[model samples]
Target chain A: MAQRIDVKDLDIYYGDFLAVEGVTMTIEPRSVTAFIGPSGCGKSTFLRTLNRMHEVIPGTRVEGSVEMEGVDLYGPGVDPVAVRRQIGMVFQRPNPFPTMSIEENVLAGVKLVNKRISKSDAADLVESSLRGSNLWEEVKDRLDKPGAGLSGGQQQRLCIARAIAIKPQVLLMDEPCSALDPISTLAIEDLIAELKQDYTIVIVTHNMQQAARVSDRTAFFNIAGTGKPGKLIEMDDTSTMFSSPTEKATEDYISGRFG
Target chain B: MSTTAPPTGKARSRSASGRAGDRGMNRIFRLVSTWSGALILATLAAVAIFLVLEAWPAISLGGEELGEQISWFPEDTSIITFVGPLIFGTLLAAFLALILATPLAVGVALFISHYAPRRLAQALGYLVDLLAAIPSVVYGLWGILAFAPIVYPVWNGIAETLGWFPLFEGPAADPPRVMATVAVVLAVMILPIITAVCREVFLQTPKLHEEAALALGATRWELVKTAVLPFARSGIISGAMLGLGRALGETMAVLMILSPGFLYSFAIFQAGQQQTIAANIAAQQPEAPPLGVSALIATGLALFVITMAVNMAARAVVARRKDFSGAN
Candidate 1:
């Protein structure tokens, strides 16, 4: 089951400094929304806050509200751990739990919540997840080999399988293809196209062409100067954002004028 | 060691002499480093060879007499070359100390690395270091006079309550200078080394791996179980072996706290019954007859062999971990 997200006037901070300010947006259910920005513009920071992962850093905090289907994730007594299970994240660099095998990496999130699993159910989950990420054909024979033994592109796909296994309502990608080659990047873009049919997907990217190619809607974020908080410049239909005039900054960023 | 490329284009002539000077210095440094390592290995080999040479007479005895000497041990006191009791005593005391120290060391290591606040963790770590810095002689004197008085009664109480168990069935003495006393002292002495090493390893678990666990909906304890523990397993084994090495070869603390007799008992609670090989050497070497000295050297050689074997075993365990590894 997919979930819609409504973020209202959200301010993110690392310790005393405000990192990103007054972000208000709605991410529709079962749709692909891409966030594109210059480096250090708080695009990745904003994605982490979606899953309550921002607070994992010491002294980092968030203000205002991030609601998933009208339930405030940061409300008192709402556990960050529970918030994370509802929204899974794939990091920029693929992380496949170096200690685990490919099958184990796929089942890691499910196993984290349930200590004991029926063998048949575990096998089914692993197969379906790997198939969903289009990695099962490549890795089905050597399922017990260490996840670290895979190439960078395959490792990223394995991480996707791991993320999908948990059955999270919203899937967050923080520049998932930035570390990948063109072929791997294309593979992920195709996977995103299929994934949005069942899950609400929000991806952050530095590549404008990728945002245009994969996203239904695009949100542009920008930083004014060093030490200044990043702000959301504009949100529009991907076709409209690319072809029509909006803000001067968004036009500059997308049209290769300047960051 | 220097394989520097020649300067190209305009700068080639200007840099030529400087590159030659650098290469000359690198060659000299490499030779010096190689000689330094060779000298250390040569010194260690000399010690082992000379020990065997000096003890040759006692070791070369005919079959029956050598066999008798090995069995009667230091207790015989005539012809005085046996060592079975000393070796067994050393093993029992060190083994007991290892069992006592390992769990406590790991707990302290985990607490400092993961659970404690930054300031508190530093203070606790410093306190453990202080435990190591206390001279062994001070540890010995404290054990004999202050520590023994406190633990003697506790040993007696354990003997009374759990006396049916052979290990607790102590013939508890007035001063209670037993193998158990030596073990507790050794555990205290080795605790700091094990704790320090394990703490460093736990701290080295990659931040990426830790965050991966957190994002998988794992609680803090689950994160430690999944990531930290697997990563630190090899380090933990090596740390424990370091402590075990110290316990095996310790001299002064065992000399002062344990009563020296040739008697052997696997029973840890028995008082006034044993002495380790290192303690026997320190106490007997000065005034020992020539034959006694030879016997001591032979025992010393045995201790060296045992320690080397343990180090080899540790290396094997640590090496296997790379292939069977759960962590990068």
Candidate 2:
């Protein structure tokens, strides 16, 4: 089941340096929200903060509250491991534990909880999750094969399968399609459209057309200069953000003027 | 040299030139490279030929001159001994060192690569490198004068508490200078070589793979278990082998730590009683007859075979684990 996120006055920092400042927004449940910005504007950094993964890096911390279903993720006693389990993430590159097989990768997240599911149930879980990712028919026979042997798009979908296997409340995708070919990118885009009906999905993309095509709502991020922290310039319905963005920066960025 | 020149061939060659000068240097490097490659096989062949020529007396001098016993004093006795015990001693001591060093080296490597803070890790790394630089004779002196005395109580305690075991069942003498001491000292000596290689390998675990593990809700240690360690297995084995190589061929350190014993005693706790091939050759080579020298060389040939076998086995381990290791 999907859950809504309420982030209030979030400031992301790597050591003493402010990366993204005062990013306050609510991401609705069962919808696709795209965070778009140029390089160094901290879109990916902000995305990582949502899942409490930003703090994994040494000396990196966040101020302000990221709430998932009324519970603050950064609040005291909230384990980052638990936060990650509840909210799954797919990285830019389709890194399917290079040591694992295709089936093992699908089982990776669930196995992290240290629960012992029955063999039949695990096989079923693998089948259903692979089916959900639209990869079961193609890979059902060779589940024992190494995951890295798959093509780029297939690997991305395998990653999606791996993430969704956890059945997280929210799925945070950070430029998941950038390294993929156009056809694979389209497959992921279509998969995202279907996935949003069940799970709250947030994606970070530099591709404006991708933001327009895949997201229900688009949040544009910007920075003043190199040393400045990135800020959310605007958030609007996908159509409106592309057609008539209120902020000059958002419009210019959308119009290919400047980052 | 900086020169602004738009020039003909003569001016181009004679100018203060990086590009033109590099061409002659490249040819020189090519010639040097050819010789370097050739020298490797040439050196191996030369060593093998020399060893064969020197050991011919022991190999051919049948009936009591050789092929009788493993004793070094060949001139005094009519029956000289084969090098079976010396071969056994060298391998056992090296193996003993390996088993002792592996866990400690891996722990130190893990601490440096994963656990320690950046500054502390750097400092520890430098200290370990310094540990590796201490001369063998210095280690021998320190082991006998300082280290052995310090370690006596602990060794005696282990011998008493677990003395029922064959390895510890022997006499636990004061300032124990047995094969076990040689092994323990070799472990300390090889620690840096193993740790340094493993630390580098652990650091080479891909950031993407590490992040992948973390994103899967793995704790720091679990991340290491799933990602860092599986990735580092080959390097660790190879590092262990490097340490093992040094332990096998070690002369001065083992020579000082172990006391002389000609018998095949299985007990490790007995002090002042062991002779590895290297220590035997180092100690007795000066006073030995031609047959004695040839016998030593033959023993050296056996050690050469043992080291080769150990290396081959290490290569096999690295190759065998490739599927699960993710190094391919």
Interface RMSD of each: 4.5, 6.3
- Model 2 per-residue lDDT tens digits across residues B10-124: 8666555657667789789999999999999899888888888887777777646453444545333322344676777887899898999988999999999889999999999
Q: Model 1: clashing residue pairs? A: A99-B326
Report per-prediction Cα RMSD to one decimal.
Answer: 4.3, 5.8
> Of the candidates shown, which would achieve the greatest DockQ relative to the real structure?
1
Query: What is the Cα-based lDDT of residue A204 in candidate 2?
Result: 98
- How far residue B80's Cα lies from its native spot in candidate 2, in Å, is 11
TM-score of every candidate: 0.91, 0.90
Tens digits of lDDT, candidate 2, A38-82: 899999999999887887689999999999999999889999988
